[model samples]
Target: MGEGIGFEQPETVENKGIADELGRVLESVPPKENYPPDRELQRSILDQLPENLVEELHAHLIVVEGGKEAESSAEESKLRGELFERLATAQYGRAEAGTQDPRLAEELSQELVQLMHDPRRFGLEEQIGGIRNPDLAFFKINDQGKVEIEAAGEVKLGLLTPRAAHQIGGGFREGTRKMVEVVNRMEKPEDSGLLAVAQSRTRGGYLSASENLKVKLIVPADRNPEKVKSLVNRGIFPREDYVRLLELLKNKDEVEILKSAFSRQEVAAMADHLIGKIRERYK
Candidate 1:
């Protein structure tokens, strides 16, 4: 819509079968009588997924069992986090047109067309922090085709609980500080930065009580949404001022990337698929 951003249609991805399979798996999930649902029941449902689907969806999955007390190991969590990071990168690259939900697909396509324009590139896990790394970064290509950093972003994925929400806030605070510190070390610091967080579909509730509190504590009153939509729909919420974060770390929390590109249905299927894989791996 501007100099760098353009409206170019992304090539259609042939993933109807994958989408249909994911849909079938989601539809098969019984209505949850409880918030987290029974662990055995959850495990059994995951066990029902076809082995091939588990393999195909592994890269898109984040397996977290036992609700508050998650059973996933550190290595497993690290692997899942990295896998989700890559998945988010690919989703941004493709603009998530492969999702089954038509409305969500259209929204993603439009956002992608608007956000990803010519002469810009998206990357994952750049070592922007001396001891830390932002999960995602955006680069600009000059006339000579050399890539230069336009912006940097951090990514966090977990259930949208109060604890997770607070963790996201703290993580972004520290990560953003690192980003600013590193950028300042350069001859010319980037004007702005992005802090992104995403939540899994294993648990449901948009802007849950804890999330609401965290949002109220961080997000500006005027900018905060009355009802926070799924992260799939709202991509990046940019803030112009970076110094505000450096100066007032607690008061002005500008989180740019807040949603996962994957819709609820897609995340559900992937979570189930990963649960199956994790069970086998740990057993």
Candidate 2:
């Protein structure tokens, strides 16, 4: 399959043909909740699917993501470490087929796809990395003939060693300090400078506010509502800032109402609904 087919080069992906299919698959989606309406159907479907299906899903994710990149061995190794960290995390990932343990590479593949479809608009993985066998690279032809790619991936949450996630997040923070030393012969110093991004944030000393500003992370969709809500009450995610997508389902043209997928108001409302019904037996 082509790289774009796997979610690579997504920026340029035309939203032209899939409108019909969306209406159908999405038909089964229940009405929006004042909160995240219990996703009973989605949960049931996910539960009923055979383990092999998940395995196939996992394998395809791995093969496709691996195929997306064609970087040098050094870069490939670096990518592997990043993927590994995502997998090792406990919270952000799904169970592997036939086992509770997660397949880091596979989880990354799925997450990569979500990242490419930037309906949420956080430019997480956009700069510095070039294309190799990427699983879900989002690319599009810009106003110029050149292509701009944004590759994305997922990992089970909380997988990294304490030091590792920070290191990887830091790589994201300041990509290629070491690369500058190695590949600087032909490009003039200014041209080299042109490639720099987010350097100011890195170069500038971290102000107290920059370090202290508490990010309002959305509460992840969990399997157990009461237990999860208890955690939320304790501030797992800043509950006040929560907005759920399900709440927006009530409004037909949510663009004006919700703004984006990650809108705070909608996500928090959805979280409230979801917290009501995560575990049917318990509820």
Candidate 3:
């Protein structure tokens, strides 16, 4: 009911004395091919939930994510898009609940609480203009606390095949290009640098790479050349830009770009595991 569920500033959120408990529970999580096993990642996040937001957070992860057959499903994409847009309504968005899309706004209200808990680490919403908008845009605060856009993020909801997952990287390239173009247009071409985050829902575990790269591609979904080509032709990217995007995809490190794409069953398995953890702690 508050700006971020029960009303709190995103940056000032504290551990609520649950970090140690989570750390203990996390030890039981087995290591997987990806860093920070899926279950463990879920448990870690569980410890961060504020009391008021727990129920809503649980619904967001389970109910909303459950209704999708594929991560790219139309309904799922639309909801995710709404979440991204509402999240940018400013930290304590003044938008009255009555004036907005009730279901979508409610979900965003819940997710926003989690996101604000770590604004710097997660890009909430990056809207620049053109078809180049990122679901979440990462930022850095200047000395005066002014935010400067540093990176962009895209979120997908399904386990991808190796070929199908390359879409995320393509998304990254498109987002970075847009951010850079915006910076240049503002007459600060030196600020043309940007970072990208690729977030996806997978089955095996929560995997992340690029401890040493400018762009951060976190999800390991697969790719489909045909589908990828279709998306490109749809005008997500201009022809020339699409060509470069393809090169970026080919030159990208697979180990770094995508590890393995999973199935809906896998997505359900991971979410259920996480939801169970949340219930154990809060219910």
Candidate 4:
């Protein structure tokens, strides 16, 4: 694991039942089918800007969003300096002559402002890559008192359908891969009491026939054994990654935390804020 990529024992969080109520609110705010910004408008504006300005902004955007390193050439730096001087003089002249707005300039300015803001409320902007966030995480303190991931799992929102199983399985792979790395970094490289967990809204019928169905399907197990096995063979199932599935409904404290983190009202309010920002920007 990278020095910066270790997990911390999360502070005990207040559980306000966000997960339990998310489904009800989802009916109204439905997970946005998609949330990309107006790419055409952005490109059109960039086309008119000085190459230096556009290049600088693009590089800045990459760094801000992904922490990637981008170094500007000396020529580009000189060009940007010259453009800034020219713009300063132009602005002074415009101020002296009384302000006037050109449609293209105004449009370009608005687009730049939006880009600078990098609105993320509804996932409007592209996110950083190579980071996988798991739903449930287990942590253990090493002898040095560093909190490390013991076990973790990726969770899907619905019952274990073939699709959901595929997603969860993929998540399990990613989560366990990281878990393996974190464990290797431990001072005492023994098995961490941590175990990966998989879950869904309900266990569903597919997992109902397991010998220890009640414990394995902690939240609820799926009933389709054949599909589950198929998904597992396809490397989409987390069965091998985790010791077993965990039902959030059975883990009282975890259920509360899940609910609090995914509450309907909280999600709605966040979405509403982003929508309002978009409307105001476009209006």
Candidate 5:
């Protein structure tokens, strides 16, 4: 998206229920003593955040969300900077597997374990890339020891079906709006047991997408067999990338987090690097 379109960025949030859930999973976080404003870092992150999300950042005591000027305030700005960074980060979203396949189930289970240990968990933005949703946030202990880690990540882990993707294409915004509604209602946050993140509506006529409109999605187990493996055995629709995505999450060596951390340029580079590595690793 370009400037002047007037799209706001989304900010990190703490829904009480979501926080409690995270506490149960990860324990014993300490509190912060010196609250300082990381104005420079905040600015850089703000630049990455969608414009609409500007309000969220400023809402933070550390960030001046008041646009450039408030950001300059070297006073209370630092006092609250620690709190804000604890609350926000970028996360990667998981695609749905659509079955109880052992392999897929195992992958999701491992992801949950990682999510539990990670202070900052992020899911990639939907196909749009940079624009992120609340799926990556979690409740964890902060330096201040207050209830931290807000907006627990909840995703419909499934491979988009031709039919579902078509539905998503027709009403991308609408579908996302509904997904947000579901996430908002979720409070427990215990890895949500692989709720079929993807849902669909079949009824036509006199139908207005009732919340009842849902589809049977995959649930995670220890074993998730490939439903389409037979159809595309060797490097077909069952593209090695998806399989690799599942496997990488299980093994530490195969995957490497950029030491440089996340940046738009770095992410682009990672994508290219992954592409180049695919032939050698998957084939």
Candidate 6:
């Protein structure tokens, strides 16, 4: 099995101390009624955090909150899209076949595929047509230990409206068509191609449109199975056989996870890079 940046275990005593201190700092913030707390008050809280913790927390908050409300709606939308994309990548990256879905066994049994985020940033547009390229691409490790594109996924945030549903279904068709052509020309082509769509919420008018898209629709799992069944009945999702739910992290949960994922030294290194950005933005 291929290794990912999985969470580290056996937390060091020093790391535990840092987490405790950070937790206390976070808890000190006044309730939501007085939210967007006083600038000086926020700064004082930031001051208590180690430079690195401040940076990590700031970056995480941007992802979770989609930046300050004062920012342009377009910018906020972009940030929210980014958050969803990263969450989808993390969810699939750590997925266990049996735990997530027995249907995933075939994909998970092979040399694990690494899912790349925003492949276009790596200047892959020429290799994979710009429109056809997905927000996330699955590159499989072949028998010879060579990595090659195996599948693709698109992520959509916000309610799944009619337009969004059309985009999702159409994109799946186009992407699959493109992948079929590319794989056919490959020296060692796989038998099938896969495309997936991930959305923030399952509520919307997508059921009829997506009935025959041949794409896997991934949505965050509700804590109650009955809630998910309700969605299926409402036609927000297809039948039970077609539903694939992933548990995504909430803002607070993500904060806690980030605290445990980094070591003191790693945090310090990241902090150094983010210090200037944080200062300029927060000020």
CA displacement after TM-score superposition, residue 164 of candidate 6 (Å): 2.9
Which of the two, 1 or 3, has more TM-score?
A: 1
**Which 10 successive residues of model 5 have the least lDDT summed?**
198-207
Which candidate, 5 or 6, has the higher lDDT? 6
Question: Model 1 — which ten-residue stretch has the worst lDDT?
Answer: 197-206
Model 5 local distance difference test score = 0.30
Give a tens-digit lDDT track for model 4, residues 1-283.
Answer: 6579655332212212322232233345433322322334322322333423334444443455475433334323433333332222222111112112232222322222232233242232333123333333333322232323333323322234444343343443343344334333433321222111111101110101111111111111122322333223334436543223233223432222111112223233433433333334433
Predicted candidate 6 versus true structure: per-residue lDDT over 1-283, tens digit per residue: 7888866444333245444544454445443431332334322323333334445545665655556532444433444444344445544433333332322323431222211222244333354454433444333332233323334444444334333344344554565455434433433222222222111001110111122333333342211222333223324544432243212112222111111121222223333333435456775
TM-score per prediction, in order, is 0.36, 0.24, 0.34, 0.26, 0.19, 0.37
lDDT of 1 by residue, 1-283 (tens): 5578644332212333444454465556554332232334323333333335445434333333322324355535644454455445444332223333333323322222222221122221253422222344443222332222322344445423333343344553344344434333433211221111111111121111112112112121112222333211222322322222322223324344344433333344455555666567644
Give the worst 10-residue stretch by lDDT in candidate 6.
198-207
RMSD of 3: 15.5
State the displacement of the C-alpha of residue 30, model 6, in Å, after optimal TM-score superposition: 13
lDDT of 1: 0.35
Better of 1 and 6 by TM-score: 6
Q: Give the TM-score of candidate 3.
A: 0.34
Model 2 spans with C-alpha error above 4 angstroms: 1-14, 35-169, 176-283
Best prediction by lDDT: 3
Global lDDT of model 3: 0.36
Model 6 lDDT, full chain set: 0.35
Error of 6 at 227 (Å): 8.3
- Model 2 agreement with the true structure over 1-283: per-residue lDDT tens digits: 6565455333223322222222233344454544363334323222322323223333433455685423344333343333233222222234334431124323423443333333133233233233212222222222222222222222212222323222223332132222222222223322333222122112321111112111112122332222322222232323332223222212333211111111123233332322222222222
